[model samples]
Target: MHKNKNIKAITSFPALKGRLKQLTLCALSGALLLSVSACSEQASQTPEQAKADFEAAYNSISTERLKNDIRVLSSDEFEGRLPTTEGETKTLDFLTAGFTEAGFKPGNGDSFFQQVDLMQITADPDMTLRIGENEFVYKVNMVASSKREVPSIELSESPIVFLGYGVNAPEYDWNDYDQVDVSGKTVIVLVNDPGFAAADSGKFQGSTMTYYGRWSYKYEEASRQGADAVFIVHETAPASYGWSVVANSWSGPQYGLVSPDQGQSRVKVEGWLSRDAAIKVFADAGLDFDQEKEKALQGPYSQALDLSASVTVNNSIEKSKSYNVFASLPGSELPDEHIIYTAHWDHLGKDETKDGDQIYNGAHDNATGTAAIIEMARAFASLEVAPKRTISMLVVTAEEQGLLGSKYYAENPIIPLDKTVANINMDAMNILGPTKDVSVVGMGKSELESYLEKAATNQGRVLTQEDRPEAGYYYRSDHFSFAKLGVPALYAKGGSQPINDEIAQYRKRMNVIVTGCYHQVCDQFRETWNFEGITEDTQLLFEVGYDLANTSDWPQWNATSEFQR
Candidate 1:
């Protein structure tokens, strides 16, 4: 359904030779002197030209178009764009049509749609938990479900094991599962790390949350160890958010890629237990939760309690088809190599609770990101000179469903991973006015930082590292899907500056926006939004892509980065 004219590939010359050739050609044609004279004459008019050009392009960006897209995507009509639903069909059709109108070729050779088979699981709350004669109510304590359809295995009634942080980090010399055979037992693990609960707070990353602390890693590690069920005790401070957030998150329709071969590489059941419910389990096991917390802060500790817990989980898994929309502008030269721009088009569909509004429009969370991708595609298409390397624009699905769309693409890439230069991901963009700095979330992880620095400098803007690395934002977005495979990714945000007052005021404003409207339905397009930041950010993004597209060199991970080996 998506198609664009395939432009002829261009030959890539060495950077220095390319510049020299252009200069020589200009000089031989006597255009260099004329260009210089014209530049001198139009010196004062350059700013006007730049402003006019940018405004014209910016004006072409229809807020109405964005609203139209958001209204449909978020409306009750789309049913929240859930995968495999009518919503998904409508969403994909809209994106496919948009890409076609934007003049992009089918990214996957001849297909605009990348088929991602998925399994949709809906859990029944009536499942019972039984440990020997002791039984606990499932609804109040935990919610369990499996990705597998016919995973025939009895609930393990073996003793529960408390694996400190449940991490296997070689760098930190930490292994919670060390010397323990948790073959078929349930593992009760702490949400975050010891450093998060430490008194000094400067020990490990100190509340900054290492990868070991993430719930995803915990689940993955447990599943790898062949644990029957992994229960992560949720706490506000250590987990970085309240249990209500977790409850709401897990209650949603869960999604995962359907194995092409239908082979099983996933756990039977994985779920979370409320902190209060976990405390009751510990109490029944004659283990003190407070004591464990206090001792864990003091030093390393691991224990396998003889307390055996069992549960019978009944869930239905259905196979469904989700889509990843791909569109690209072919390179003039080195078309095999690619530079990918990604943004997720999915959000938490409709939630009836928490302020009466049912639609999670996600206008700012991702609608802005999706809109930005379209605009970028248009800009790249408008360029007179095609990029040297292929430019792939990927608007993925189900980002709100735990980065499933991006994850599938990363694992089964249409283009080989080795030829992929770098992934530039746009999540929530700044709808506020422009600032003087641009913030890189996972800064110093790759050579992409250098490229961004160059782009920022060109725009008279400064590049900054994230002020709050403790947020672990690097691991939260779709970029992490690429990063996990050693692909370099850059997740940058619009920066903040003291436009009229102290920098603290600017930061406060940013925090309010992030915490308040970030995931809420109120993230709608506003007339008061100054597109200065969007314009500057988009231009910087273009420059980054341009540098990558023009050069033949591949971007590498920084030497000190853990991903680089």
Candidate 2:
């Protein structure tokens, strides 16, 4: 129910920073000379001995252990592992114990916990939106929130402008706001980019949603554009999810890092309007929604609508602290450099309004990822010869809350980002079974794919692109946080194609749960679930990390990648 008394927390950044300096010095000093010497000896071993060492350590990733961890973490007793809740206490305790048992030293100085200050903003649902003369109810036709960290957000009769996709990508030679000034006005944008609408036209990765298509990017772009408010018209196909997801996800308590400005530079209000509601709103302004959308797909477009909108959101703000759990196996030679592995431990928590099952036990959503990271740590620790570069496991908090935890850690890193070799992120892992291939999300973004290909080959498998690249899986996970800062990140997992016909049938049944149980109460752990796929995937992660850890390679982003440093 509570953290072990042995566990300690690092309360100040100055102290944490000093500890980081101390750790770096320790890595380079005489203290680790013996460790480095041992690694040098291990590195010079015969090929057969090295292979045996790898095999023995790789086999330590257990499917049974993964399953057990998932069951325990996803149980009702954990209360969905929400940050700043009782669940967080239990989750942190579990992670600290797991890392200690696995022989990792505290990654942050003398403590395993790096405190992340967070602000939780729960928007009052009893809100209304008036676009022109048309009124829309909250969560019925629209869902809204503010990042401004204020008591209330209000837009009074703000002029509306259609700013197609709300993208400002100069590299794409596109900027919707280039011709229009949306400062102090409400901007309405379509979900996703023109790529989704015309995939074959070779416009921005063709249906594979670029960062420009992401709602978060849109909001950020709008804030930079000085827009008072921004609303994205939600179409299920383009958004990669239905309106229900938007409503449910946006309606809940949102967590953000405690900022100095309290999000003063952000747009006053950010929201989603149902497609039907958007259509009606456009029609009310005497604009044909389809025709306008078509114009948007062709090129940069914007139009001042003959209407204005009004809305007020009263926020119930609560400032609290969360954490990013860190466990490190200091490398033999390059302990100062890090191969960071990340997974979010926080979920949707519970919804008391639900009749029967109130707890949203996010078993598949993240419990699997959390378990995999712990196992990966265990495997690395079991190795007779530690890696040349430190392998650090960061079980971040509040991922479901807009990747706040990872974002915080990335911006304020314990191990310097420049010194961080590469990031390997695991979120909802495969539950169906082993596959002949692993699906690499945003496959072409990094050189890490080469390492992954080699690792997968060892398993007699191949690496392939994810099935739904249009979903923008790359930008949706914790890896994106590191990637945003130019760190090459790999987010790949088991493909949909099962290894055998028997597992293929099992895949069909598992697909229902995987697809439907996202962020729902039905996302609880089931004994019938298969762990072979995730286990193999975990081992593959180990292989790649092991290789990176043993070598002096610093993985780089592809030259064409937006994140290239």
Candidate 3:
């Protein structure tokens, strides 16, 4: 959902929030140039010109309609749009009505909903973690969870191992796990990568983060090592979020992609420890935590720590149900092939314990995106002739719980993967007015960039590469669920190029949103909010899908992309 520059640097999207699963942000701008080279040669105009002709129709997507959708969806009446609650019923009904009004059919083969079976586990109070003689209080000193469907997970006095960056990249000749067996230990790893500390572009893609730096990768690697637990050390600078984010995330019910074996393959304990707590643990073991951390960034510094830790987690879990909204505008020429648009409709729901306003009211966090997708559905249906490839719009649930709904859709796609053309995902929509460039989260990963570039040129705007590769925004979104299965996906945000002399103001806006609004109760919409940016980005995306729907060409991941597999 969001990306950061690197652990040490704050370049593009630095303050981007990492929610329960890092739900993401962004937007774009510019105007198309029109020319009259020949008064009599209208048919010979360029493809750009052809799209310019249709620009008016694309612009027909009124801001009033967009505002209306956001206003209604994010309203307190919906109860923050949580899943398996009254919110789910109201949201589903609203979406189904919108799709039906737009002349779309149920994409789930005779049903407007796609069933996703999930298990919700709420961590009970009094969770305990002990390191040597020091006991780390839950939420205050440590936080943990297990994906496995069990009432409790208890690890007795597990040995701690220090894994440098916890990465095993053969291409980079880096294997932090070498020369040691971590079969039954807890791996203590740093956030981000060594390249971030060195500020050298040559080291693990320099400041831009690769998949290896993501926390998800750390846990996966731990599972591979047959470790009982994985604890990622959280530093404000490197992690791009404060301790509060972790505390809030780990305090509640967490959901996972329910496995056939009830996540039997996942690690028993995955958690985070505050930097201060990690430092204390090292000092108690007679090691200088700072010196050890410095060695971690110096390259190839993996060793076993002399610390022993114990973890215990008890959960009050209940089985729950959620639905993925799938509706389609069937293509005229090749209805079987499809172009999909996705945006998650679920937020943190409502938190009654929090003081002041308890409603998370994710107006901009995702109501903007969810509303925008439905608006696009309306536009596609109103077209004089249907697009060549079917346009499927998906409003998924439980993205806040780690892209669960999207993952389910990818694993159990209503349409076969082979026939799916491409996917375009919209996270938080741009609210910072118009700009000169559009931000593509993974610009060079696939041939879809060319299509996006073409559309940008048609609108007289340039493409901006994702500024925070370190944040792993590309892997954080719902689109990633499709990309892992070989589908070329474009997950992007509005560009940073502010129009007029508003660069400073734009930065200020992003800072406020990043620091305060994300996943917080203050994320509600404003009456004075400028939605033109969201409108422009939506239209640009519509044009991209419109082009792909009408063309026979298929988008492919670049040869260098890891997802090419």
Best by lDDT: 2
Which stretches of model 2 miss by more than 4 angstroms?
Answer: 1-46, 284-286, 351-358, 512-515
lDDT of 3 by residue, 1-565 (tens): 2211101111222111221121111111254222211111123435676566456458778788999999999999888877776766778878887877766777877667887776677777687889889988889978988877888888888999888788877767688887768887888999887777776546766666667777888999889888888999998877767898788766776766667988778778899999899999888878888899888877777767788879788877667678899988777668889999999998766877778898878998799999899888877766555666888998898888788899999999998999999999998898777768999896788999888888888777899987866667888889999997899999876788877676548656755765668777889888767788888888889989989987999989887666775
- Per-candidate local distance difference test: 0.68, 0.85, 0.79
What tens-digit string does per-residue lDDT give for candidate 1 at 99-162? 6666677787666768666665666666666643556555466666666655343476666887
Query: TM-score for each prediction?
Result: 0.80, 0.89, 0.84
Displacement of the residue 295 alpha carbon in candidate 3, Å: 4.2
The segments of candidate 1 whose C-alpha lies over 4 angstroms from its true place after superposition are 1-82, 85-87, 128-135, 151-153, 199-204, 260-264, 294-301, 348-359, 498-520, 559-562
- Which candidate leads the pack in TM-score? 2
* lDDT at residue 38 of model 2 (Cα atoms): 23
**If the candidates were sorted by their lDDT against the true structure, best first, what order would they fall in?**
2, 3, 1
Backbone clashes in each candidate structure, one number apiece? Answer: 3, 0, 11
Among residues 3 or more apart in sequence or in different chains, the pairs in candidate 1 whose N, CA or C atoms overlap within 3 Å are 9-332, 10-332, 10-333
After superposition, the stretches of candidate 3 with alpha carbons farther than 4 Å from their true spots are: 1-57, 178-180, 283-287, 298-301, 352-357, 466-469, 501-515
Task: Rank the models by TM-score, top first.
Answer: 2, 3, 1
